[model samples]
Target: MTVCEMCGKETEVFSAIIEGSELTVCAACGRFGKMLRKPVMRVVKKQAVEKAPGPVETVVTGFASLIRSAREKAGLTQKDFAMSLNEKESIVQKLENGAFVPPISLAKKLEKLLKIKLVEFEQEDEVSNEKRGSGPLTIGDILNVKK
Candidate 1:
């Protein structure tokens, strides 16, 4: 069943031009506009596409302590380590304090420099039987307008 675009009534719809804009409205609302064609009833079909689980790289838990311990073991102060990494000292401090999460590139650099395992790969959650198709949404469907 198709719904009228203007009045939101579930009935047959006709393609029409109302106030210079096209709308799929019912027969009652169609009188407010110039009818373009015959009434149209749309049939929506949904198909589920299976998605394979993919590998996603993520930082290990307790990364801040791991990085701090590794850096301390390497006998490098935060400032010196930041200088060696070409990053701000504040960023290094934030990383050690668990306030910042490093991107993949930075994590790789840290792993190489500190000789610590920072990134781990895990399989992403697979999505099964997801619905795909629905009718076009009207403005009323999107926004809660007060009368």
Candidate 2:
């Protein structure tokens, strides 16, 4: 007969074996042994929360507004636009609402679908006005010499 160190019980046979050691335990002690055994798990779940917004939010805002305006002008709802792009409606909504940054591929697809350029540039009218005010000059003007 052997004794269980945990419950101070003696038994005819060892009820639990751990790390090359046998435990002689009564029925009540055996229940305690089962409790001590570790459970086998392949994966453990972890919870994640969304990160807080930062400086990039401003840039995303401009992109989101551009996408929203283009979609609206094209007469498509968020669901309709997302379906056309083979993407989730939530993704379109998030982009429209400035909740997420869109990948370049998505932006290019949007530009093609909407037929509107989304690139950032100086206002066309402002640029044209500047060009108009600048009088025509010859090659001599560029060389800083009068013909």
Number of the top-ranking candidate, with lDDT as the measure: 1
Error of 1 at 71 (Å): 0.5
Candidate 2 C-alpha lDDT tens digits along 69-91? 88998899999999999999999
Tens-place lDDT digits, model 1, residues 1-147 = 688899999987889999999999989999998999876445798988855669989998899999999999999999999999989999999999999999988999999999999999978764323332365544544353448
Which residues of candidate 1, in runs, are more than 4 Å off?
1-52, 130-147
Worst 10 residues of 2 by lDDT: 122-131
Per-candidate TM-scores read: 0.54, 0.39
Candidate 2 stretches with Cα past 4 Å from truth are 1-61, 119-147
